[model samples]
Structure formats: structure tokens, C-alpha cells
Target: MWFQNANSPIMEYLLFFHDVTFLLILIIAIAVFFFFELIFMPTDPHRFLIDNQSIEFIWTLTPCIVLLMLAIPSLQLLYLTDEAHGVLKSFKAIGHQWYWSYEWGQELIFDAYMTSIPYRLLDVDNRIKAEMAIPMSVYVSSTDVLHCWTIPVLGVKVDAVPGRLNQIFFSLNRPGIFFGQCSEICGSNHSFMPISLESMV
Candidate 1:
């Protein structure tokens, strides 16, 4: 319930997977508790005296099936997040010690610093603007220490390593402003390095 509303296809898939896995876990826990109660009843003194091979086999196979169900979809989502083909727009996000800089091509570049005005720490001096319904690629790197660029609503997070470049792909489904912060602890002002993105049609 605390999760932010999903604004992209990947985020929707992530939310669906989370709900399905949670339901599976709840069902397994309840079933296990029920079996424990039935097996350990005080009135059934001979409960441990009998064993059924069929029941043993069913329990063993059930867990393996459950594991497969969880694994297959998880692997698919992982692959989906990494696929960056046919990206219409590409940009670079360079993280600094306490701020973020963006390059939208050779012609446009700017630094986004934290502001204390309307949105308080969540607001920035400049926001990244882009169109919706277009596949976009973002290359992330760090200029100083380690940092992470993240946007939860879009389900995009990539580490900004000092010497290496990491990339993430996503398409926004709606027009709105999304906020995220540096997930990695880099310095004393780590919390002040906020990320703001404004999506449009």
C-alpha cells in the first residue's frame, strides 16, 4: 500500500509479481500452520505412527512447482529491464558529490541542484523533461564518489560507478512529476541529492 503508483509498463509488471508472490507465500504459510496443528493434536497420540508415501511426494513436488512459478516470471522481468533496443531517445546522467547533471545531447546540459521552495527537499532547480510513450535510454555514471539514480514510479534504478557506465531503459505511460533520491550513501549530503523528472505527451 505504501508503494508509489506505477507509471510505466515495467513498474506494473513488478507490482503484479509482488502481489502474486505475496499471495503464494500467504497460502503456503496458512497451509503449513494448519498441517502443524493437525499433526500435533494432543488427542491424536498415534499421529506420528503412520506415514503415507503419496502425501510425502505431493508435498515435495508442490514446493518445487511453486519455486518454478516464482522463478520463471522473475527471470523474464529481469531480462525485460535490460532490453534497450529501439530506444528513441538517449541521455547521460552524471552524478556528483551532492548534485546531478544531465546531458540531453551536445547542445543541452544542465545541473539540477536541490531547492527548498515548493516541494522542499524533493524539488530541484532544474528538472529533466521528456515525452511519454517513447522508449528512452539513460546512461548513468559518477563524476566523484558512488551514487545511484533512481525513480521508483518508473521502476528505474542504476548505480553510478565512478569509472563505469550503467544503463536502464523505460517508457513513461503518463504525464506527471516523479521524485527519487540517491539510494547509495556517498557523503554527508547524500540525502540532498534529489532527482526530479517531468514527463509530457
Candidate 2:
């Protein structure tokens, strides 16, 4: 079935191995956790016992084997995905207190500020044309305080730390204006720091 599927060799290996590894580790964890008892028993009944080290071996050995299986292929994939693979462009995004600055280069960059609008408000807002779709690459870092750049659907979120440059890489596989926010609390404007990305193509 894997060979029949049309995808790259590395992608195929990863897809198959990831599941196999997860199942193996999960089974190992279940075996260890259930070994001492059907589920988990406590050294002391007083503790609610949400966590236990009963399956230490299962957890340890399985992860090691999974990593070993993954490492060689992962490294190979990383090497193959290098710059020489294709012509990919880079963008830089800087995070301010309540807005995001995107830079393609010195000549081309834009500042996207979060506007407070109700669900129905989008219907009237012509400026909100990208309410769901604008093709762009977002790179985020901070100007001062710490902030978290999150977009759940794309599975790309990272923190913007001050003084140090923190970067998160993502492309809009889905073209739409996605919602995000500053997860970390910073100053009086923390609650006001709403984030939204307008995906376009």
C-alpha cells in the first residue's frame, strides 16, 4: 500500500514509521502502566494518582527505538530539503505591542494591526477583504516583551522573546484569515493584543 501511494520516498517512510512508532510506544506504555495493575495503582492511596513511573522501561526503550528509526530518515529528509532543493523565499516578521510588521525586503513590507470587530462586523468592513484569504509568509519576533504567535490550524506557533530573535516558519496551506493572539501576558495591552492572519494566494 505504501509503495502504491504516490509521494516522495522520505515522506512515505515518515508517514508509515510515525504511526508504527506511535503504536509501538503506546503499546509499550500501556503494557508498563498495566503491568503493576490493570491500570495504575498507587504507592499511597492518598494521592489521586494521575501519573506513575510504573512503565519506565516501556517509555524509555520504545522512545529510544523510535528515535533510532526516525533519526536516520529525519536527517536524510532535512538534508534533502535544503536550499538547493528549490527556490524558496524568506520573510521576516517583527511583533510590536499590539501589531505585526511583515517584511519581504526594505522596499516591500506591511504592518497589520488587529481591529476589534464583531462576527457580523466583517460583513460591512471592506478593509477586511482578506477576512479569510491572503497568500503570505509570516515570521515573528518581538520588539520588547515576550509574546506568543499562534495559529492553531497551521500548527505553527512560537514565542517572541526580547533582545533575542525568535522565529517561527509557516506557509498558508489553507488560504483564509485565521485568528491568533498573544498567549503570553505583557503589560496593559495584553488582552487587547488580538492576532489574525489573512491568507492569500
Compare the candidates by TM-score and give the number of the best one. 1
lDDT (CA) per prediction: 0.94, 0.55
The window of 10 residues in a row where model 2 has the poorest summed lDDT is 120-129
lDDT of 2 by residue, 4-98 (tens): 23123334444566567678678768866765574355555425434656656656787788678768866775554331322244566666876
Tens-digit lDDT string for candidate 1 (77-151)? 999999986899999999999999999999999999999988988989999998999999999999899999999
Model 2: runs farther than 4 Å from truth? 1-25, 38-89, 107-109, 119-139
True-structure RMSD for candidate 1: 1.5
Evaluated against the true structure, the overall lDDT of model 1 is 0.94
Clashing pairs for model 1 are none
Best by lDDT: 1
- Point out where model 1 deviates above 4 Å: 45-49
The residue-level lDDT of candidate 1 at 153 comes to: 98
